[model samples]
Target: MKATTRKIRDADATKARILAAAKSEFARVGLGGARVDEIAERAQANKRMIYHYFGGKEDLFKVVLEEAYLDIRNAEQALALDHLSPREALETLVRFTWQYYLDNPEFITLVNSANLHRGRHLEGSERLRVASRRFVEMVRDILERGAGEGTFRTGVDPVQLNITIAAIGYYYLTNRFTGAVMFERDYMSEDALEQRLAFNIDTVMRLVLA
Candidate 1:
């Protein structure tokens, strides 16, 4: 039994390594540019083992994309926004979303790669759909609470609000280079980031607040 347990742990570790390597490769260069051999090398595993565990390059990419989405969703759930007051909850969510994008830029790249293929892999992910629904519900509840307290307008679509929250942060970071070139300033500077975060929170609050 001990030997069997050891074998399971080893298999899990190998799988985790492969996934970590693949995520980095895919995020760095996107799915079209990512290579299985390079991923194996980075993971310190044989190419055959990668295939044995994850089927092939495309399949592995799908798993990596799913995992990236799940990671953000799981983190958002952990924030427990429901426990906070409506205004505080909305502000906290906006701040969290911006920080999350900053901390996990790889997630943006992975999502871009998935979008390039028209979300072919994500279409089959029931887990993603369920998690997304839960997240939307959370936001909806927040909006309802705010409306009930007469601090926010009613009939705000949570989906659109969520999209706006993500887009404000995602677009800024994804285009930081061009923005810097065009604007002649460092969008990532300490002061610049703080200002951007403040602007994002204010934008979100104004959109929903009464």
Candidate 2:
């Protein structure tokens, strides 16, 4: 029994390692550029193990993206929206979303890469689509409630608002390569980034609440 339990634990650890490595590779190189051999090397596992656990490169990519989405969803879920006032809820959502992207920089890259390819790789994944819609619905509920309480403007389309908020956060992280060249400065500097976040939150609040 002990030996069987040990094997199960080892299997779980190996799967975790593979997922982590796959996420990094996909983020760096996108779905098209990511290589299974490199992911195998990074995970310290044989290439065959990746196929054994995750089927192939495409499957691994899907899993990695799903994991990234799940992380953001889980963080948003922990915001305790019911306990906070309408304005506070919006602020908390904005702050949490910003921090999530900042901490998980790889997520931004993975998403941007997928989007660049028109989400072809992710189009087949119904679970991912559902999860995404659920998050959108959560944001919509918050906005609707705020509007009802007069804390937010009426006729604000939640989907549009969510996309705008995402654009603000994602552009800051994903546009680093282009922004550096276009803006003539380091876009990743601490002070500048904080200012950008503040600007984003303020802009969102002004639009939705004022």
Candidate 2 lDDT by residue in tens digits, 1-210: 999999999999999999999999999988889999999999999999999999989888888887887778777777778678778888888888888888888988888877787877677777777777877777778888888888888888878887888889887787888989998988888988888889988989998984
Give the deviation of candidate 1 from the true structure as CA RMSD.
Answer: 0.6
Candidate 1 overall lDDT versus native: 0.95
| Superposition TM-score, candidate 1 onto the true structure | 0.99
* TM-score quality measure for candidate 2: 0.90
Quick one: best TM-score, which candidate?
1
The predictions' CA RMSDs to the true structure, in order, are: 0.6, 1.9
The Cα local distance difference test for each model comes to 0.95, 0.85
Compose the digit string of candidate 1's lDDT tens values, residues 6-111: 9999999999999999999999999889899899999999999999999989999989999999999999999999999999999999999999998988999998
- Any idea what lDDT model 2 has? 0.85
